[model samples]
Target: MTPQNPNLARELSLLLALATLWGSSYTFIKIGVETIPPVTLIAARTLIAGAILLAVLRHRQVRLPSDRQTWRRFFLQACLNSVIPFTLIAWAEQSVDAGLAVILNSATPIFTFLLTVLITRHEQATTRKLFGVIAGLAGICLVIGVEAIGGLGESLMAQLAIIAATICYAGAAIFGKNFRGLDPAVPAAGSLISGAVILLPVSLVVDRPWELSPSAASILALLALSAFSTALAFAIYFRLVQTLGSVGTTSQAYLRVPIGVAIGIVFLGERLSSTAWIGLACVIAGVAAMTMPRRSEYRAAQSAGNR
Candidate 1:
């Protein structure tokens, strides 16, 4: 694919949409976790989202693969993508500030890039991508405010947990490439169903969810988190994984920072500092650098278009 490919623009737009869904998820989670235990909350989230996706599949007359090998891969994707990371972030959010979580989680593209260079060799570690990684990280620091780092050392374990979750997300993005041949919804639904299987048992054992009474607000927040953030977001996520490649897809991590700040300003009457405006520009530039076609591909595309 090249810069002239129309799908490139559409995929990047979907990438931004994915970032927006996930950016808002932090607010939902904060509210939901107030009355629900982390394990139970995440379990319910996977359950509801998985069920919804399955219903959509049924409505479309699509069937999940019954092969043991495919199901096994789904289980692995679930562990990396949802079960472990979701639980860690949920638990860590109890102690870690949201700013710290945003910064740490936004490191996914960096990790994904490194893993590709060192291990998978699945994608090129181009100069543009490296610049994107650095610029995006710097932009996140500015957008979230430099002062947010002051609380970093205070919540030692919680911060570490969030970092661990970020690592898991990177791994999941790389691993997700294995399902490129399947429809995006297949892996999205399969992984969530697998996540539900793993988490529901743990929720029963650890949280005893039946005895808990969650507030209406928390329940509503969980519902939104599950439906929009998990189900819809994952579907978009898998599609990007196929269309954009892992590093390109995870660029949404950087995009999420600005989107989160924009959401705050719009809905919560929060204001941005001058640095944040600069950061937003950096984010847009970085995403463009990372997602734009290579110069050679661009030249080739232009030549082909003229033919």
Candidate 2:
């Protein structure tokens, strides 16, 4: 099968949608975790999201992959992409502020770039791409402010957990390349199902969710988290990885910082500092640079120009 070429407009829209979906997830997690344990919250999120995706698959008559190797890959993807990161973020947020969490999570692209260079070789290392990653990270620090990094030393374990989650996210993006030809939803559904399988038993033993009573608000937050943030977001994420490759997909990390800030400004009546506005601009520029055609593509275009 021919590689699916990236459509700038469509992919940008999807990226924005995904960033918004995920950026808002912190809010839901904060609300839900007030009454629900982290493990239980994660399990509920994945299980419900997995069920939703499976329902959609059945309606579309898309059979889940039956091959053992594909199933193994799906399980590994789930561990890296959802279970580990989601659990870590949820637990870390119990101790760390959401601002600090976002900052640490924003390091995903840097890890992704490093993995691509060292292990995957799925994306070539270019100076432009490296600069973009650095600029985007700098933009995140500006947008969130340097003060958020102050408590990093206090909550050493939580901070490290968040960073570890970012590494898993980077790995998942690269590992997901193996699913290029399959339906995007298949890998997404499979991953979520695998995450649910891994987390449910633990949640049952640890949280005993059935014995705990949760508030209506927490329940609704969990529902939204599962439906919008996990299921739908994962579907789009897999599609983006297939079309744009790992580095490009993980560039959404930069996009999430601005989106989160925008949400706060618009919905919570929060004001952005002058630094934040400038940082947002830098993020846009960095993402554009990162996603721009590579040197090979540029050279091919130049040669065609002469021809």
Candidate 3:
């Protein structure tokens, strides 16, 4: 659908909301992994978020798919969306700074665009999208400041893990389109349930979470992450996959960098460098370029000629 469609506006707004939800997740994750082992932390995240989504589904009288094939797809989505990426990010955060992680992980749209053009051909590969990718990357580099790059070469292994997780996210955005026929919450809930099932056993075996003593702050952070970041965010995410297509939906990756910085400004009394202000503008422009419907560009060109 074109950006002129009213629904597209709502979807774009949802995209911004999704960015805000996920932007705060790094802080929550950093706090959560302090005492809780990565496996245990992510296992609980999926479990809690899945349960919440399931409850919402039930409230809406929606049921998850019962077929084996659908469940298999859900399992794969779980791996790409949560089971692997979640654990990787949580583990990496132990050694990697959140700034570097955000900058590296924000490359999801670029990967999504490449994968679409090369493998899936799921969406149109327009020049606008290509520009969006370049601009978004530049914006992220500026938003985090040059100082953040100092950690890049230091935590080589952990930095690599974040990139791996970013790739998984790219795959998830494309694959998630497969669930278009189902209610957004159905796949969201199903995937999280699948993730919990996969990770719980591993957490039990590896972390022995029963013996661990987590701080109250960490526990609260886990709850916030599970509820806001995972449960609610996945519901919105799946909807955007249906409405916005993969590349457009993944533009939220660019939005999250600036949103995270804004969160810091409001809550932590942080000030943005001039570069960061410029980065915020670039991010807005990049997201616009990525999401602006082709028809809008045509209308603008026609109007300019008439003028």
lDDT: worst 10-residue window of model 1: 1-10
Clashing residue pairs for model 1:
none
Positional deviation of residue 89's Cα in model 1 after best superposition, in angstroms: 0.5
TM-score of 2: 0.92
RMSD of each: 2.5, 3.3, 4.3
Q: Could you estimate the TM-score for every candidate?
A: 0.93, 0.92, 0.93
Per-residue lDDT over 1-307 for candidate 2, one digit per residue giving the tens place of the 0 to 100 score: 1123435567778888988898888777877887999999999999999999999999999999999999999999999999999999999888876656777898899999998898777677888888889889888878987676566788899899999999999999899999988999999999999999999999989999889999999899899999999999999999988876788788888888877666666644645556998788788877877776755665664576566
Worst 10 residues of 3 by lDDT: 1-10
Better of 1 and 3 by TM-score: 1
The clash count for each model shown is 0, 0, 0
Error of 2 at 126 (Å): 1.0
lDDT of 3 by residue, 258-307 (tens): 88767666654555667998898889889988887777655764565566
List residue ranges in candidate 3 displaced over 4 A: 1-6, 264-271, 296-307
Quote model 1's TM-score.
Answer: 0.93
Segments of candidate 1 deviating more than 4 angstroms: 1-6, 264-271, 298-307
lDDT of 1 by residue, 1-307 (tens): 1124335668888999999999887777777888999999999999999999999999999999999999999999999999999999889878765556777889999999999999998787889989998888888888888777677888899888888999999999999999968989999999999999999999999899989999999999899999999999999999888778899889998889877666666654655667998888888888888888776776765677578
